[model samples]
Target chain A: MENVATGEAQRAAELPMDNDAFAGFYERSARPLRAYLARVSGDAALADDLMQESYVRFLCAARSWDGEVAGRRYLFRIATNLLKDHWRRARSPSIEEIPEELFATSPDAARIESQFLLGPALAAMRPRDRQLLWLAYAEGYSHREIADVTGLASASIRLLLFRARRKIARLLREPEAEGRQGRAR
Target chain B: MIPKSCPRQSEVAAQVLRGQWPAGCVEDLRQHVNGCRACGELVLVMLAFQSARAQAVSGPAPVSAGVLWWRAQLRRRNAAVERIARPILGAQIFALVVTIAIAAILLVAQARNVPRWFSWLTQPGQSPGLHFEDLWSSALAMPVWGLMLLVFGLAAVAVLGGFVLFSDRPRQ
Candidate 1:
């Protein structure tokens, strides 16, 4: 298969859908999809690139958007596949990036502070761990849906998710423990 | 953070995701989440994820939706062009190969039996110039026919291959 740039780099003017209709879909799906890619791939820029390409592929896909929920799932599945393909084709592994710049953009101080902690823990965990947690709690996708998006078997999601939660819990505890020591000192 | 999970933790998370937490949920579940260590941690993490999602959703999209849609349209068009071009290119190559093969067979058969001084125009007198009548002649053995066919085939391939190579060259 060709890379993400194979098509996006080319000029296309074949309008397959109404402009306003696509705009609505893009507005609803873009940010959340970016967030999902950023956290899972640990590269915010790649997430952004991948997000744009995913929509392009999504629109180009032959399937119907009959079910709105199904459309969202299909979008995620496309993004996930693209991300995996990027990782597979890359000469070196992608570096983990939390996009600390984004934290300042958020007006909610409390949420930002919590995310500061969670981001690293997510970054420190394996790619699949971040994927499972983000999809499960962040997107609220069920185990079966997670299976569909990640291309993992449904039966293994629970055990894998359970292990992922435990790992994050351990990672989260360390900084808190350090903070407690610093406070006591 | 707790490594263990409360039985209702997933349930509480589901409620939170559905945006039905605390108010929509039964009072007992709220009390339990507050009291259970695992559930409390779960709540904190889930809320953080929710807030992060909110921030991302509210943030500006990297590219405008209109541009994205256009690019998607363009990409689809490009792919369609590629899909159509692929078979046409394949058929062109197949026809070229078949033409060369037929040319080679005819050339080789003519070469094997005909004398070094053969002419396309039939001679006015003497033995007919290498006509089909020569097929049973002593000079034209079966192996000679096969050899001639081989030579003719090679000539055809060379001629066709050269034509293809020259035709494919880019114009200055």
Candidate 2:
């Protein structure tokens, strides 16, 4: 009986840091997660809040984390769900308010500024289109990676990216980028 | 679907951005983009987006010197959530509760002098020094039969309660 108790205690000792593991894991994944969230929401504050919530969720789920599953991929998967939830909770605007200074920043400015034009272009897109563009372009995800991230078929990634690019290009060409919707025809 | 009016190379640029470059198309796109300034510029923006994002700070914002203390508080909050959730969700707790209930009912029936299967087993006729009242009353009374019955009862309760608590029932 004593031996069995000791063995169980030893096994528990080797398991992932029950609560202590969250700090290190959060530190490791936070930066990329923030950037990913920032681009998706186009609002830094909202991204920050989502980042905190995502990590809290990560910590809660960590009790179930098997060390073999790549932690980063799972975390991103969680973040993707949270992002979808965030979007769903938001009411759709009759007209998207496009910012005029999209892409107006110098190339070396903050990525947010560098992608300002892309931001509204992203905002102008349907949520799925925005997700496809961000997952591919900003997250450095391959077609397969985007497919995993968004649960879309891998074979369709190229076609979807193509469609996303056309939409962005059409948006960029609008004479009044903010007020008028792009006319692809 | 690719817009029919888009330059052939722009489609290639999207593929390249996705790291899915087709060898045949890359060269053709390169030559066309070299000749066309608009396609060339779009390619630059796309490439820049990728590069800049790669360098972006992803996680939490900057924290002050007392982040360790703040983290401790967050840990407490998380632990509290787990503590609350565990009792509601823990299989063992539910099993323990059920076991205690069953044990109490058995002990009560014994107290009431009711003819219980347990009392019948522990009755003096079948086994010496095994009457529940005497075995429990006497000092150093091992009450082997009662002890064994108690252990077996607890084990059965644990197993049965576990199945009830953990097994999923199909919705009607």
Candidate 3:
């Protein structure tokens, strides 16, 4: 541990963001990023893990962003990619229906289970639908920004967002009234 | 489904996200949200998600920024070193292979002369100068291709090793 820290200290001169600068960025972005991850992934523990990895990867990226907004977008991009990789590796295709039992083990897990009121309402929806809705409405991302963060085609974001909003509105309109909407076009 | 988006939807949603809907919002825009389906749904979705976000962020405080910063710095440095080491590792293996090939070729070339060289040393009444001459000839008897190949191989290994070790392409 001592040797690792000492070696890191020696190479610290070459790093882009110093402790204070990274701390500022981390403070400004961490909560929102975690919120986005948790809601999309339906897992608090994975959200925390992915959030840290996203920051580390953002720090490691070779290009410099134009400003703080760009940095935040890039951070989201990293988080999204990490989440995609996690999903692929875990082989759980229906992430929206992430089992309640999965979170029964911890306090944060329990909080996540209780916090997302709309989660179970639209829990059967596709992962992409949850991601698009969160990025669009919750994050206030324009269609273009949502496309950028989620790696969807920009031209398709409007239609996708519309479909996602329709699903959420119909589902949230009444818990008992779900799946009665005549097959949506 | 409306093919075109309602511009007022953005205004209403933005206001709601800022938690100033209806109060900070003008009466005219508030009425527009009530009438427009897009804007109405946008308000409901945004409000629910806004409350959900509050609950989510309030669940648990993440790790401290200082810890994140320190760990990121360490991981980034380690990744950079790993990136640079990959090509160097390849070059080192290439050098080792070439060195072994040279040793094998040399062993083959010197095998025929080994007994003569050993007997020349064991022979009595011969001057040390004749022994030196035989050894020199034995060295010269190695094939020209073998000699040139060894020199070329060593130079290639040196060049590749130097390039891979010195080039500093950072990991993304």
Best by TM-score: 3
Candidate 2 iRMSD in angstroms: 7.3
What are the Cα lDDT values of the candidates?
Answer: 0.71, 0.58, 0.73
lDDT of 3 at B145: 85
Per-candidate Cα RMSD to the true structure, in Å, reads 8.3, 11.3, 6.6
DockQ of 3: 0.31
For residues B67-126, what per-residue lDDT tens digits would candidate 3 score against the true structure? 766776667667655654566678667777776777687678668867765664677556
Over 4 Å off in model 2, which ranges?
A1-29, A59-71, A89-115, A173-178, A182-185, B2-30, B35-45, B51-55, B58-172
lDDT of 2 by residue, B1-172 (tens): 4434345654855665675543545576678777765565456546645654656754235443134334544564545544444544565566667677768766864574445335546664874236666555653454466666677777978686655654343311
Off by over 4 Å in 3: A1-13, A92-116, A122-124, A179-185, B1-4, B86-91, B94-112, B120-172
- A84-183, model 3: which lDDT tens digit per residue? 8997788775554665344222455545454455876545456677788887767778889988998889998889788788778877777546534433
DockQ of 1: 0.28
Worst 10-residue lDDT window for candidate 3 chain B reads B163-172
Question: Mind giving the per-residue lDDT tens digits that candidate 2 earns over A1-185?
Answer: 23443344344333244445655666556777777776666667677777676665555453567562357666677777887777556553311243323313223334545335555555556556666776665555677877787777999787877777666666655625534534432
Residue-level lDDT of model 1, residues A1-185, one tens digit each, is 13333343233434545688778877777889999998777667788899988988888887656666778888999998997788667643442342323322223433444547676566556676778899988898998999999899998888788777765666576756534543696
Q: Clashing residue pairs, candidate 2? A: A30-B58, A30-B59, A31-B58, A31-B59, A32-B58, A34-B58, A35-B58, A102-A117, A103-A117
Candidate 1 collision pairs: A12-B74, B104-B152, B104-B153, B107-B152, B108-B148, B108-B149, B108-B152, B109-B148, B109-B149, B112-B148
